[model samples]
Target: MNADGMRGGGRTLAAVDPAPEPPRVGPGAVLRQWFHGEHGVAPIVVGLVLVWVVLAAIAPDFLSAENLVNLTLQSVPVGVIALGVVLVLLVGQIDLSVGSVSGLAAAIVAVGTVTAGWPFALGVLVALACGMAVGLVYGVLSTRLGLPSFVITLAGLLFFAGVQLRVLGPLGSINLPFESWFVRAVQQGFLDPRVAWVLVAVWVLAYLGTQIWARERRRRAELSCVPWSQVVLRTGALALVLSATVGYLSTARGVGYSVVLFVVLVIIADVALRRTRWGRSVRAVGSDRRAALLSGVAVHRTVVSCFVACTTLAALGGILAAGRLGAANQGTGGADTYLTAIAAAVIGGTSLFGGRGSAWSALLGVLVIQSVANGLTLLDLDQATRFMVTGAVLLGAIIVDMLVRRRRQEA
Candidate 1:
């Protein structure tokens, strides 16, 4: 062959040869990537740990079994409401009426069971229905009538507050029987130590099983998967942390049934949001409503569902609170219930801008809020100081969120 032809053939061979594959990412890099991901929950987790440590140092009793048990109980009502708030935020909507809705639900339960001579179970169901009905109205007003959610829910807040007052009458309070099943369940029920340990084991096993299944599925689909080593390490770490938590709590009154309920609800919500079509649709709508509509998502339906979920959860929270306090009164859902619930959702790393959050945010956020309140009380601080501190923490969370969002956009 001629020299020119030989040279050309060599160039073609070099061009056709596959470039060397990029270096495989190490487990450490994978961990870092996961931590810095757009939807990462690492910041909130780290912050929670930091807060706990600081509070423990300041008030040794803060870490006492009794105080921790009280803390978990205190977090229940706001935590439940915050879960629903996470859903609403996911859909880029707000419900300012959650506190009022809770108050109304409590009032309904009180009136139906005490005044109207109805069964407790029946009264509870009616209260839930009332919540759902109010949510439906709010959903219609906001979606069908093209009204802003802020305005609609603000009106709802006032309306429900009035209803709550009227239902309670001039005396404005009704004490629940302390020995009632519902009250006992909320305020006194706790898991046996054996059961708590078994549940923790099951949770760890389930987590590992899911991870393994996901890895296999990804491999079969020819998609990238986390290294098996990384998976094992993560599972081990999770098991250790969960086991420690359960053990510590068991030394006290054991884990509260309310805490278990909150955890289960958060898990269910997390799964639904991460795995279900409806969850994806809600996220898409929140991210860009016009785009979601163009993609054939039922935007109106998603909005309605979110509102309904929010109000329903709110009602459940109120019931739980009533059971804990052994009463439903005009003050049932007053004070900063509204602010605290919303702040907990946001501070737990749920983005106010929407389209990014987790149900776990509610759990973590409420813990932070409750920890602050508990710590301040132990130090003999007044309500005004508590409010200021909580407000500052909330502001810091928002600032962090904004910075993280900006970084994500830049990336």
Candidate 2:
């Protein structure tokens, strides 16, 4: 008997032993697990619900369909910007110039199209290309020149702001044609009720399919898969919630195309971050750059790509903002814009310490910020009050993050 634990006979005892039974988990255990992590979405979700409840109590119209639809629309521009912030935060970096980049894009689009008589499409392309170029410069400085991101992006913020002023060329503002496709689409577009329902069904099916595929892969690998009961429960809950939301929103304008676009982007980002090799590298580098480099991650390339993505998204947000507002101005994307985006990303549970966050954070965080702003406006609160309240919320989120990090360390 070799070591006695496993015989070196015709067949070892280990080989003959049945695989251990998968642990049985009840609904209570499942709920606890879902809410267990510091970075989990469950907390923000609960918080959102409480905020909505409070606002609805104070102002009855706050829950009305029209108000909710407007809230969703109001969220898109900053929400898109916040989405990029999540990527940068996940990779343990910062870009203070997003607002400036966005403003420059808006100015370029407005001037190129309206002033230079260029086609709208050409102007948009140029703006995006400019964003890409800015990101490349930042990447080269941080990766090749060994400059800190904070300093590099701070300089970029000032530089781009100046460029934005120059691009506007003293007019300080330009208005798009009111009847143009861009303005109409942003201001008046809404999903058809039937189309919205179909999309919801597709989303649910896709989710169910993904879950099933994951479970099968785990089973094939001889790993413990989540029970089918849990899978079914989750799927049902998601379907019901989404269907209800669609139904409620349909009573007013249904979902806006802008909201749909934002959601699609979030879904894509979430998948890329969670499933792709590049996503894994980003997280690994964020956790520890030296360790990731030793493990053969292309840290420099990853950083460059993330910066490029961040700026590109910021430019897109600016374009959308221009469309929605029917004009571009010097004040189109200002300090408040970037500050709100960062605050939303942090409040939505993205760890400032890096390597821990989700694309969903952008969506939830923006919703929280927008909800607060909207609710305050409804209460006829002054801008000062809004600023103070937002600052308090941001501070609270930071404190929570620090406490969670310390707990992990002590553990």
Candidate 3:
């Protein structure tokens, strides 16, 4: 194959196939292809870097301290929602109910604490647990009952909304005290700018170290050892952006509490789906249920777990929404959070067909979607215009994915 063909083929092969031998390609091209193959996040990262540069040039205030912190806060919640979507996408399913579940969770938290006088901590836990429980139920229905996740979670979207209305009853709005530690932590920035950089360092070190350790273990087991240079280059590339971005944002107003929570959620989720035995089975079942069954993977269990994980995360997003909104109302999740969540996942590079995605992709996707949304809204554009633009972006993502898929088959 020619180098361009090899480059096109290398990406999809990364997740599902072994690293192939190089064809006729220059050393520089080989390195570029390898980097793109292993880290699907790189393209999105470049896009983000470009965005920062353009936005800063166009609107000097775009990189100002206040705006930077707000951007982090905004990015964080979407990142959280995307994490849940990633799990479902990995398992070859889609949950349309996440946006609704998010609304439901926020309504419950607001109603339980603000209206019903429940403790803030207990209310938050209950909201989150309930969201997770609802997800688990959907998983059972989809896996045990053999209903499609599309239909199941779609029903869940409505079901959860009704639950939200019932909880909010009569008075659709209530006040939540901002003094509580949990509330403050979820809403306000912690770890001022300097500490935010330190936290980012910890995240980079821990993530790379864990992956390197895994590569070493594989080498010991006679599995392919991803080259040391490959690991180093990828890690360094990631560190450059992460360190710079975190430093820039922290200097503005320190890292937003929501962004930190978002990062933590993504890490937990990525680990759960990619690092665990259950995570393996989830991917296996999604890629091919029959093959998974033949290989002794619990196809049913994996499917159910994937659904449960997705819904629970959806619920968590709803709670985060409540924090951002400062109340639960008819309008809280009414902004099509569910659709956006799906769009964010799909556009962030999650496969619509199943068995290919990453949690980090969700974060990146959300950033893209929200950046566009926010940028448009700032120009005083109408809702119709925004929706039309969003539709185009979503369509573009699907096209890229299909093109990538076709190229993979050809290879």
| Higher-lDDT candidate of 2 and 3 | 2
Write candidate 2's Cα lDDT for 157-267 as tens digits.
899999999999878999988887777888889999999999999999988888898778867876666778877888887899789889999999989988999999998
TM-score of each predicted structure versus truth: 0.93, 0.92, 0.87
Task: Tell me the tens digit of each residue's lDDT in model 1 across 1-411.
Answer: 000100111112243557644433676555555555656677777777888898889888899988989999999998998999899998999999899999889889988888897988998999999889888888899899989998999998898999999999998999887887888998899999999989988988988888888778877876666677777777888888788788888888989998899899898888888779998998998889999999999999999999999999999889888988989999988878988999999998887767888788899899999999998898888999999999998998878777876776775
> Per-residue lDDT for 24-91 in model 3, tens only?
33446555563345225555555556656765675666667777667667766656877888888888
Which 10 successive residues of model 1 have the least lDDT summed?
1-10
**Model 3, 354: alpha-carbon shift in Å?**
0.7
User: Cα lDDT for residue 150, model 3?
Assistant: 85
Cα miss at 387, model 1 (Å)? 0.2
Local distance difference test, candidate 3: 0.72
**Model 3, 391: alpha-carbon shift in Å?**
1.5
Alpha carbon lDDT of residue 386, candidate 2? 86
Candidate 2 regions off by >4 Å?
1-24, 402-411
> In angstroms, how far off is 244's CA in candidate 1?
1.3
Each model's lDDT comes to 0.84, 0.84, 0.72
In candidate 2, how many Å is residue 221 off?
Answer: 2.5
